[model samples]
Target chain A: MSDPDRVLLCYCTCPNPASAQHLAETLVRESLAACVNRIAGIQSTYRWKGEVTSDSEELLLIKTTAGQFEALKERLLAVHPYELPELIAVPVERGHAAYLEWVRAAGGD
Target chain B: MSDPDRVLLCYCTCPNPASAQHLAETLVRESLAACVNRIAGIQSTYRWKGEVTSDSEELLLIKTTAGQFEALKERLLAVHPYELPELIAVPVERGHAAYLEWVRAAGGD
Candidate 1:
């Protein structure tokens, strides 16, 4: 059984579907994530250089473990288009036991 | 200034867009959430009753605070359709200060 506390759900936004899919596949294929769920049709509103900006973006919910976060972040940044991408990890307080295990195994840690 | 540690990003999934939108709006309008971002076209794969299942779902990225989590959870459960809804709160380790404040004010605490 995987430690639930170590499980993380990292959130990031992509400019388009192709890039999102590519990133998701790369993460999963490289075992950096157990699974990557790409959510389409999201509008992000935020501040950029003192101005409020909105953009249509695809969100990537990357499932991995805390142990792998550092490496995952490095790899994501290397390929990501944004200068400052949203790489926030929210700890998974609780989840299905089997599903959590799958995440651990997929992350290869 | 709102303490960063008190902020939370709650994650949940709905069967469709309307319910997700309704829940999101209700949370924001009722001051239970600062803002709710809905992402459409997500596929969730998990196990249920010893069987693996996959479903098309919409994900809700709910921004709130730790101080209001309990009430938020109660309200979410009351209106949520699932018998066992996925209400997971992930701590926001870091974020843009201004954006974080927006979340806090929107959640009303």
Candidate 2:
């Protein structure tokens, strides 16, 4: 079914590991995400406020189903520390069936 | 344009940072991807060969347009160390117009 493929891998960046871990735990505890992978040692380069900027940031890869996206985004915005956090969703095209099911179940279906 | 929206954020895991850096550089130099973010300290848990397995792996968040996905996958497969690597693609739903354009241009669009 398309349901599993509709699972999303959401990406966001945090200023530090503490905030990143806090957000990740909250999302998983609230069932907004099945799992959240916190990645450290990421150097991001981008343009901000008319200037080219770069930062050492932690990245959060949040996994949840499409149906939960809106709620997840709302919660993320409410707690995220950034003025304009990078909240991007990408569809999971394929994966192991059991693992995908585990993700769905973790997101509280 | 739709082309920019068609940009992808491909995710994969490598055994170590050296392999990850090698792949990332190769992808960029070959124009298969606009950028690749290497994140260390990733803990991946999944079922493998009838058992659940976990590993500390480096995650590669690869950015490229949709058109380059096939070639990128092919190149990745040819060089990846895993017997069955996790090659997943997620469509970028939204991003800064300028940044998205930069990604497309980097992918050789």
Tell me how each candidate scores on DockQ against the true complex: 0.22, 0.22
TM-score of candidate 2 relative to the true fold: 0.59
> Which has the greatest lDDT?
2
Q: What is the TM-score of each candidate against the true structure?
A: 0.59, 0.59
User: How would the docking of model 2 be graded?
Assistant: incorrect
Local accuracy of candidate 2 as per-residue lDDT tens digits, B2-99? 45438888888999978877787777767787666778878999987899999999888887887888899999999899989888976787544455
Candidate 1 lands at a TM-score of 0.59
Q: Tell how far residue A97 is off in model 2, in angstroms.
A: 1.8
Candidate 1 lDDT tens digits, A48-79: 34343456788898888877777788888878
